[model samples]
Target: MSTDTPPPLPRQPAAEAARATEPASPGIAGVDDTGVPAGGGDAAEVGRGFFRALFDLSFRTFITRRLAAVFYVVGLMAIGIAFVVYLVTGIVEGVGALWFNPGAGISLIVATVILVPLFAFLAVIALRFVIEAVVALIAIAENTERTAANTRR
Candidate 1:
């Protein structure tokens, strides 16, 4: 035998050599590539992520459903309060006119007779609107609560 070592064995083909050099892709035994695990973290993280997404969706739905009605009611109450202030101011001015000039008392009397009934009608309507809005808000709350309970189940 010769003292020098023999040359190394022949090199593999390019494709085979490349594949052999690289690590094999990881895989699940019973599942496809799409079903492979994330390689880190506990299973409970999946459940937590699902719940967070669900809560976000529910909150968005609730706001979308009630936002219009909530704004409408708020607008109605604001207008109603403004009207009440106008009525009060009108009455105070009329009183002042009557005190300073008795001749204007007849006009004030006529205005009171006409405007008091109109304002009363408006007030009644505003009260009804407020009551309806409150009822609707309560109904929405109950419905949302029921939906949340059902979703939990």
Candidate 2:
């Protein structure tokens, strides 16, 4: 037998693939929170399937990809809550000290007003990238599976 590698599949832009897929309806039954189809499995199927996959010893199916969107949203919300808490603490502390040291009080107030949002924005951007990276990896895995399936045919 000849020892030769097959050529790689051609990369197509998603816009081109969009033409092949069915038009997206607002509410798809088997869709994940990320709005992606959950492998065409409905709620009961997902529940049972996820449970089975969760216990899968061979580790074929992935649960992280399905839950990544939820984790991302939760992380963002946590940062937002922390931002509010920090802002409130700064405001209270700064205002409380206004009577003793006007300059320092004003400084604290200004820093709180400017820095709280700045830091939160930075955290959000960072979280977004981290989540995106994870999602990207999941997508790569999925694409690899698709390619493998096609190659078999």
Candidate 3:
């Protein structure tokens, strides 16, 4: 027998070995959260399914569904405050008028002209929020249905 040990078998390239032996990443392969490989499914389909499930679980659905109600409450509170302010100011102006305070009348007119439109603009914004919220709610519902269907497979 030869004194020197035989040279080790030629090593395979790391990249080639890794490619041959390693399974694809979870989403890349058909593997789901359970780590069981999905049976011979297209990788793209698997990826799409994974993301759809993720989206369904996200808060997008919850915020969308509740947004309209939240905005409506906030808008109501703002408008109520505006009305109360207007009423209080009117009362103050009336009392000041009895005392012939010109400054109070001028200030009251300025506030009425400027602040009413500002509040109206805010109301319009709230309405827009309601619309957007409704759209989001619909999207969430549709997504939930799709996800459910996918999971059944």
Candidate 4:
């Protein structure tokens, strides 16, 4: 029997793909301190610009509103994993058996299993709220900066 290769998969038109990949015009790109596009700046300059933009009031608020739920879920997952590690360590070290008497061990484990997740959920919720508020404050500062610039103009 002769071996045969499969036909090539469909592909995007080269001209269309090239246009999509081209960088934005300088007018649309953010200017670094040196008056060049941020993409052309040195690593330190770019880093500073990124942080500045991140902390800008409007941007910060936008990010916080859009990402708070995602961050909260991630925090909860992290705390849940931490609780698992703690439980494993306790069991491995015989802390449960040593600290609790008779049926108390089972009860303690049950309580821990339930309470750990509840605490983690509550903590994440609080953290999200705090982060959102901080971001909002930063956004307000950014808005003030813009207003000042516009007034000056």
lDDT, candidate 1, at 22: 73
Off by over 4 Å in 4: 1-45, 48-81, 89-95, 98-100
Ranking the candidates on TM-score from highest down gives 2, 4, 3, 1
The TM-score, computed over Cα atoms with residue i paired to residue i, of candidate 3 is 0.36
- What alpha-carbon RMSD in Å does predicted model 3 have with respect to the real structure? 14.7
Alpha-carbon shift of residue 133 in model 4 (angstroms):
1.3
Clashes of each: 0, 0, 0, 3
Winner by TM-score: 2
TM-score between model 2 and native = 0.69
Candidate 4 lDDT by residue in tens digits, 110-152:
6666776677677777877786676677557756866898899
Q: Pick the candidate with the highest lDDT.
A: 2
Q: After superposition, how far is residue 36 of candidate 3 from its true place, in Å?
A: 38
Q: Rate the local accuracy (lDDT) of all candidates.
A: 0.61, 0.84, 0.64, 0.64
Clashing pairs in 4: 57-138, 57-139, 58-139
Query: How far is each candidate from the true structure, as Cα RMSD in Å?
Result: 21.7, 9.4, 14.7, 12.9
* Poorest lDDT segment (10 consecutive residues) of candidate 2: 26-35
In candidate 1, stretches whose alpha carbon ends up further than 4 angstroms from where it belongs are 1-102
Candidate 2 deviant stretches above 4 angstroms: 1-42
Candidate 3, superposed: residue stretches over 4 Å from native: 1-99
Determine which window of 10 residues in candidate 3 has minimal summed lDDT.
59-68
Q: Tens-digit lDDT track for model 2 on 74-124? A: 998999999999999999999988999998899999999999999999999
User: Which structure is stronger by TM-score: 1 or 2?
Assistant: 2
